[model samples]
Target: MSGCHDCADCPAAKFPPPPAKAAHVIAIVGPPNSGKSTLFNRLTGLHQKVANFPGVTVEHHVGRLRADTDREVLLVDLPGVYSLLPHSEDERVTHDVLTGLRPGMEPEAVLLILDCTNLGRHLLLAAPILNLKLPTLVILNMADDLRNRGGQVDVAKLSAELGAPVALISASSGEGVDKVYQFIQGTAAGRAKVKAPLIQLPVLQDIPKCRRWASEVGAGAAYRAPEPPRWTRRLDAVFLHPWAGPLIFLAVVILVFQSIFAWATPVMDGMKTLVEASGAWVAPHIPTPLLRSLVVDGVWSGVGSVLVFLPQILLLFFFIGILEDSGYLARAALIADRTMRKFGLQGKSFIPLLSAYACAVPAVMSARTIENKRDRIATIMIAPLMTCSARLPVYTLIIAAFLPNRPLLGPILGTQAAALLGLYVLGFLAAVLTARLLKSSILKSGGTPFVLEMPPYRWPTLRSISLRLVDRARVFLRKAGTVILVVALLLWVAAHLPLQNGKPPEIGQSFAGQIGHAMEPVIKPLGFDWKIGIGLLTSLAARETIVATLGTIYGMEGEAASHGLQQALHADLTPGGALALLIFFAFAMQCMSTLAIVRRETGGWRWPAAQFAYMGLLAYAGAFLANQLAGGAVTRLIAFLQ
Candidate 1:
């Protein structure tokens, strides 16, 4: 009866067994930039899932820990709170969860993370938490920072005064982490309890007596006359300069994007070739045409489409990680705050908007950092306009095939690269316009004042960066994997069905072709053919799937251009057609995964459905105009030349 039971039915016995000790729910709480997330990551590794607390937009990260021989604990990384009194949705969720007032959950232990150097201010939240009487532990994180500053904490003495154990842990370096884990298990299992001095409470505020205890315990832990690092001061001068900071940030962003394209070209080419070779290798071995098409056209093309963007995505994250680690991101946020306020957005929304350029999934998720509901929703709505990497293949292919390589402003930049840059600018402008429009009309609200904590610059650890890269890649592959696989197979079937007189049917006669033909008139004015129409249809599965859809529809085996696929497309598609296709891809709601996530985030299908409808209309209208303009221009130029 005392042991854990796997079954639901307890033999209808005389006495109900005492409830097994409830598993301890430890909440990790601290201020922003206090290494709380880092500690959570180190403890949980990859065993964490992100979800929103019920009825709230705030994200909740939950992970399990095997603390001791037989004890399992659930660790919750609560949103960083500056105080116990909630000022934002994130803080409210944290507060509710801690007080057991959330819809249906309660934490049994609170792990208050305090920065060793800033303990005076960080202990404000800890004082209130101790009053909850939920068995607390004080984790003096960044202990190494104290030592670096010519200071040290007397942990044993600190524990004696605080009425609880104090562990001097360096979350980043894993110093003293095991001891903290051991203490958690020991306390949860009731094997040992430290009875240190308690801070007497004043009946009014329910303040715990632990303040005095902590003060006594931490008396020698305090130090004075710590020298500031010269390099940090020098770096901050240039990085946080009011006049030149914004300009430098912009230049850095442009350089990163340029590098993404330039550096990833060779790797992307190699992937394309590999995919093609893989298709060829598997083709002869597969017996059925259906199976062959499924493997070569569906699976290879779909996976390849996702892989092509890997380089750009990784590059974006690389720069993001560096900026985040170097503490430049917070400064950037500060610089952008005034500008963002005009559009009813917080400065924190800037990163998410920037990230949307790579993909909207992370961008939308990143919106959690934006505290206000209005800002978060407005940010989400405009995220798709940020030119995600899924649109890159379409943009590059069109530019290569139709746009001349000649430079517009002399020889410094190619016309194609210029156009690519224009597209990025266009996406940014569209997002800005859309956000403003939404704010003024549908989601009007005051912007949240930005008060971001700017941490000191630090050398980014390779281990952390590597882990983030792997985590992002794994997430991308997983989300795009199954959906891509099924869609690919369906596309192949659509493009290769109904053999006619022992001859493999031409695309025009295949199922996809017929469907495209049926919708031709609807899109004909925009210069798209039935094949392009079919590609657009399959794109609903995922925006990147458009490339694979085209590959399959063109009777190509894999992700790469076949012997004549590009040439054939160029010959068949007028300049207007290319422009129209590019415009469509730029604006269309083509990612199903994005829609699903939006639904989950917004708590209903209403917003997502509206998003799809409005975006679809915008795509069609934009593409129509682009086609007319580009087609007329091409015709006039050709005539003049003749």
Candidate 2:
């Protein structure tokens, strides 16, 4: 039952009964970041099942891969782990399933996904699989990436050393997949357990021997690496340089933020024109003012609100996909490690926090990679404090309206971009502080050391990155369609209903307006008016909803110009109030989706509830400071200039 081997004692060896007809279970196992998920996506494409692995929250994906005319291989994508020796939930789940020890689950064969880019370390995991004596096919994923990066893997010798088939395939490009089917068809080898050399000891002393054995097996495959990790080393030289590395990373981050506003401006303006044109064309044609009002103000306004954010969302995800695929994020993580350790996190935390800029739900979920319970929870708790894309619309709305588009420091960076960058930096600082507090107080499993595997660099296909971008857009649009759309509908209904003296209702007299008024006492000290109060209340569901809610709220008041909301925000909000609002959103865990995900990932309500409370207090305090500090400073500067 030991996960280390599929010998005579293994359940897999006994169950199939030497009959080729017996259902052959195939498990895909690997170290983290080896593109196993990418391979799973290719092999199972739209034909997969996702469920919990027995008692744990970790997902188990089961899919069918065709073997031949007679049989279909059941492919289980085991959770990525380092070795058969269990340390975390992922490792435990993977081990139980591979050993056939978990109730009703026994994988008869294994497709060990090894990184050709890092074969030596991968062999540490692969060695134990070979010991299981089960038919093991070592898959060299990212082989193309390795070769392109000036590295090589001797598949022939690797197969010989392990007595198993090895396939070099670029799972990302969908290349060399047929080799897998062909190998499965030849299934004569690997079905019966071989007497793989067994390690003599389970104690700590023998760990080096296992790794040494792995090293020896790897040596035959030239796992010693056929050549110096030339390109990787060169790239690392610049990217991981003590001075250049941090500088380059900061510049890249700034460039990413600048492009979000710069590149997306054209599309955003175009959408505004389209929405205005559509509203203008359709508004005059309707015979009745009531129907016309609903058509123009309710639906179009709601739809238009969400549309404004589309460009930013699409571009943000596109950049993230490129950075992730190019393997530069690993470099970024490395660079961030020292800084992260200061805040009670490590390099491993940087990716999820970076991802939080796009959205916090997946970022919180990504924290599971930390393995340490306290660190994982701390990461989750502060992930929302990162400047997610949802906050982009709100930031832009406030900035574009109030802040002049004048150049800062003589045109290299504009005031708006600088302000935007400052907000991002602010969010990062807040997250660092929050993590420090959590680690020092609530979650004090301090400072666990971890290694980040740097994957080989490749020219990732634009098509693949685009496909991923499209997926992100789909998720955003799905939320827009479901949650934002419903909230918009309700807001519209509340604003238009309860007519005053048989005429159109004044928005201030409507149901939503009353709610906004009730919230005014709480928001007033922060310099926000009742209308801002309404947007704040509505946006509790989704951060981006603030933009749409503001758009809808203004549209209800019959504000119709293309730049109407922007101008309105400029006119309605004092510089202090606007700054306060932006600062508030910078720290607020306002997205219900983020809260729900934290609940699911933590398996309780307590953490999510705590997250909401602590983040709320931070948002309030931060806003109060921004209101007091920025408002007075701006006024004094204005007076001095005058």
Candidate 3:
């Protein structure tokens, strides 16, 4: 009844044929913990771009093959998933793209990367993908690890079993990756040649059938699963123990905090001297007074202050990258599950929360992997409460100014490092309490099971860790140049306005001063003066902006003009005010970028609005209390010592 009587006269006959050999756009996909990302980086190097998929906050990496030829292949590194079935946002994006249902360049072929050491389970994912029947090359990554551990797999036999070509490579060390390039180019060239289409395999509709198929395919291919490494089992015995595990994790945290101060001090000082020398060298070149002031006092001083802490921030990320790449972070998550359950969160939330230490934007976006909506929102809501790198400048500035560098634990930890660690603990405690409150109230939901595959331990490669630090530094420097630079220029204009006799007014009578004075009454209870009030307002753009704001203001002031930021702050803020500032930053939601991402993730302004108001109120009350109590205690201690 629905037959097309005019089939020969259809629109297909009128339109021109598609290209003979279109540019190849291959997809690199695999299960979590597979060496897919490493392979992608190996093939693309620094010639890659990252952007979010359409209609979602999830990001995908697009890169061209780093080949020395005219022909190029565009590779989309889709989010890692175990199967094509859409359980979470990541899986859904991968599924849509592979199926040609999404608005993007459909993959001409797929590079199915999997860990050869664990072929039984990894091959389970191959079933659904092979049914799609695209030109697929099953890339068994970590071949060196497999062979070192006595695992063996016949690549030719495996290729025959799956009815697709296969290759083995060590993505980390760049071993045998040329086979990947060959396959890509060959697939592209083959597109122009006509051949008989292969018959489609029956669909794998259920997990049991898929599993049976995978097992049979493995048996046929002579796939031998690798023996678990001896060191991994031994390490797990201690690191994954019931009681000792958490204590070890705590010790690791303490070591990281102590090292942040002790190890990074000299590097920070060197950076500070370099910034000052550059400013001094350039200050005399500008002829006009206002131009000199803007260049030397405003832009250089403000941005330079934040740049000094780059060493400390990178040190923090260095440790994080090592922990993650070494596979200890996953074990840490398992250990934290017990405590997470007590606070109404699951173990799966730990990774995102831990990632928040570096930045909250990606941490929030990573929550798309959580299956439960309520649990996902709760993680998003509390992610900002973690002490991110933006808070490092404020914390280090205040701590270094007020707290002495006296050693608290001999050579292990110092007074300043202890103070920094306490601030971190305070933030984490606040996040847990807030999670408890939210989970018990509006966002309440039933507990969902958290199952994560434990990755084998491996020594972190230097190349990977260095790459991470480089990326972090680029992001930090970019912000300093753009956002911080623009803010400094605007502040300088405001601080020198309404000139009398064509000369700049004193800071007290300038437009910036009047604005700060108006807000002074509101922050007076927290031991803040007019200058700090101005810094607080500007900090809403970014938490690190407060440091830059203070730097610009102090550069304009006459007193302590030659001193560094630490001395300038000591001249203005009391010990209590210094403590209050740290407490305020720990509790406040001072990042506009974080707020915008939260709004996008939650799909409305309600969550971010509520989050902003709650954090603001908490910061004010906490700072007020610290000012009243700690101020007196510190004064008494100083007098007693004298």
User: Which candidate achieves the best lDDT against the true structure?
Assistant: 3
Model 3 segments more than 4 A misplaced: 1-23, 190-205, 241-251, 345-429, 438-447, 479-481, 498-500, 524-532, 538-586, 590-612, 621-642
Q: Give one digit per residue, the lDDT tens place, for model 1 in 295-342.
A: 877788777766765666676677777778778778777877888877
Give the per-residue Cα lDDT of candidate 1 at 363: 67
lDDT of 3 by residue, 480-544 (tens): 34555666677777778878788888766788788899989889889999989878877876787
CA displacement after TM-score superposition, residue 129 of candidate 2 (Å)? 3.3
Ranking by TM-score: 1, 3, 2
Better of 1 and 3 by TM-score: 1
- Which residue pairs in candidate 3 collide? none
TM-score of 1: 0.81
Q: TM-score of each candidate?
A: 0.81, 0.71, 0.77
**Candidate 1 vs candidate 2: which has greater lDDT?**
2
- Locate the minimum summed-lDDT window of 10 residues in model 2: 2-11
Candidate 2 residues 1-642, lDDT tens each?
333221422334334433555555678999888888778767766445544443455655666563453555667888887887877777888888887778546776778887777777777787777767677778888766677657766788877777778899878887778877766655533444444433332232257776777777777677535465677788889988989989999987776666665676788779978997899899999988877877886677667756666776677667667777788877887788887889988776876676677667657755755656677778888899888777887898788777777766896898789889999999988888889888899788745456676765656667667655555455445444454456556766776777787666766778878888988988888989899987877677677667766776677333344278888787788888888998999988777666755765675578889989988998999888888778988656434533
